[model samples]
Target: MSRGAEARQGLTLIGPPLFYALIMLAAPLAMVVTFSFWTQDYLDIDTTLTLDNYREAFSQPIYRVLLLRSIVISLVVTVTTVILAFPMAYFLSFKVKRRKTLWLFLITIPFWTSYLLRVFLWKVILGYNGVLNSALQGVGIIDEPLTFILYNANAVVITLAHAWAPFAILPIFVAMEKIDRSLLEAAEDLGDGPVRRFFRVTLPLAMPGVMAATIIVLIPTVGDFITPKLVGGTDGLMIANMIQVQIGRANNAPLGATLAIISMVVVSLIAVGIYLAGRKFGGRVE
Candidate 1:
């Protein structure tokens, strides 16, 4: 085919997806950005551009506190999920000799159910009169149910970690599978012990997957309101919950848009920082 014809054909193939993204993603993002600079009255929106929303978002102690809490909670969930996932991914990638597909299917059984259902299930398991309390009582482990296990930041972290576990595992498993086994054998031949070999060869090569899993888990978990709403109680509520309130009951679309914009900026900065830091560390290791 001629060059011009080839270019036209390529554009034809990608045009639908590009248009879809423009409508679905870019257009909504633009609206949010525009609204962030606007003001909201009780019954009407002031379309005139202003920084009042951003100012309030920054000046308010509650917004700052919630934003920080959201970041911390997300970090906790990301670390916990990745750590827990690593072992399963490792076993599947290196140790599983048969039925890996079956094992993976079982791992993903949780996804087959609705995400809200999973959150509710965790709530039930952790509630005062729930399965965990009943089991502990039956075993005589405690005279009273543990109130500390539910309705807090800890509960939020646990629920989010559990919810995102499979997401973390898949990326790491793919990364592990891509690793050259010959490098590991060579390390062993050079008198490297199992632990040393893993640190030098396996872990370094798997960093990309680990980083991918971290980003995937961290970003969504930070914005997650459903889990926190269902199981987090007051102490567990994150920025997303506050945003929901602003947009819904509070009827302050401008403020909600501002908060959402700020969140996206903060997440973008953190993600960039993490990528840079990881790259620097990886380069030093090399």
Candidate 2:
């Protein structure tokens, strides 16, 4: 095939997928936007254009609390994951000499089980009659089970952080691996120490991955209901759970749609902002 023909062929192949994605995506978002502005008739939508849903969403103090709490938890999870993943990624990229695939597989082994099972596993480990308590008692370190370990904010953070650790690590590892080894060698030749070389050379180049990992981990968990519902009690209920309640229990479609739209909008904004932020994080020319 000629060059022009190949170009045309590739475009033809790509166009359909893009078109399909837009149709599938555009319709739902339009519906959400429409619903958010319409009035709620008790539990059903009246579908007439009005600002009740948005006004209701903004006017309520409870919704604001939930929104703020979700953001805070997401931020904590993002920060903690970044810190933990950085060292692991650094070791994986710079230190480990054997079984890279094996190590990666081990990291992903947690995925073999269902996510619900994973949350329950944490519950078991942190429960009063659970493994950690058993170990502590066995070792005579404590005479009683700790009340603060499970069904609290800290437990929520700890569980989400553990669940999201791999999300941060893999991206960072990929970013680190993408760096040219010659740059590091050149830095060392100029008398740059390990610490200097990392901050000056490695960190900057690896920043995109770090940002990607943060976004990847933080976004889903921000809207996550399962982990919080299963592991967290009253304190851990996020905006998603509230959305769920409105839709499931209250049978409030219009309000649920409004909440869903608001959540989606915020999540989309944060995701784009983070992705752009990731792309420009280190201010790297490339």
Candidate 3:
């Protein structure tokens, strides 16, 4: 076929799905961006463009605190998930000689149930008289149930980390699997210990997967409202929860949209920063 014909044929194949994606993804985002510039008064939306929402989102102490807390919580969850997942991924990739598929299946067992169910299960485990406290009491470890575990940021972190574990593991596992085993063997031959070999050879090559997992766990968790709403009480509420309140209870769509936009911008910047940092580190390793 002529190059022009081939190009046309490719466009024909790509056009529909691309259009669908734009409508589904881009349209809502564009609407939110638009809404951020307008003002809403209870039942009526004023079409007059204004910076009030943006100003409030930036200047208000509550918004600032919530946004900061959200970032901190997301960072903690990402770090915890990745740190825990790395060992499991390494075990599956290196230690398991057979039934790796079964192990992976087990890792995915959590997904078999509803996400709401998992969150509720964590709630039950962490509640005052829930399974964990009950278990501890049964064993006489504590005279009373712990109050710090549930209805707070700690609960959010634990639940999100657990939920995102598989996401972190799969990426790192794939990266490790792609690594050439001979590199580690060669490092060992060169008098490098197991730890040294990993840092020099295995870890560097697996950085891409680590980066992927980090981004995967970091982005969505930042904007997660449901987890916080269910398990996170007032002290645990994040930026997303504030946004939800603004849109739902407060009936301020413009302010909510502004918060959402600000969040997307912040998350995008952080994600870009991480990507660049990873690339620089990878380059040095190379």
RMSD of each: 1.8, 2.4, 1.5
CA-RMSD of model 1: 1.8
Model-by-model lDDT, in order? 0.91, 0.85, 0.94
Root-mean-square deviation of Cα positions for candidate 2 versus the true structure, in angstroms: 2.4
Worst 10 residues of 3 by lDDT: 277-286
Shift of residue 192 alpha carbon in model 1, Å: 0.3
After superposition, the stretches of candidate 3 with alpha carbons farther than 4 Å from their true spots are: 284-286
Clashes of 2: 0
Question: What does candidate 3 score on TM?
Answer: 0.97
Please identify model 2 stretches exceeding 4 Å from their true place. Answer: 1-11, 42-44, 272-281
lDDT by residue for model 2 over 19-96, one digit each (tens)?
898799988778767766776656556767887778888999998888878888888988998999999998999899
For 41-88, candidate 3 gives per-residue lDDT tens digits of 899999898999998888889999999999999999999999999999
- Ranked candidates (lDDT, high to low): 3, 1, 2
Comparing candidate 1 with candidate 2, which one achieves the higher TM-score?
Answer: 1
Residues 199-270 of candidate 1: C-alpha lDDT, one tens digit per residue: 888988888888888889989998999999999988999999999999999999999999999998899888
Off by over 4 Å in 1: 283-286
Error of 3 at 22 (Å): 1.1
What's each prediction's TM-score?
Answer: 0.96, 0.90, 0.97
Q: Show the colliding residue pairs in model 1.
A: none
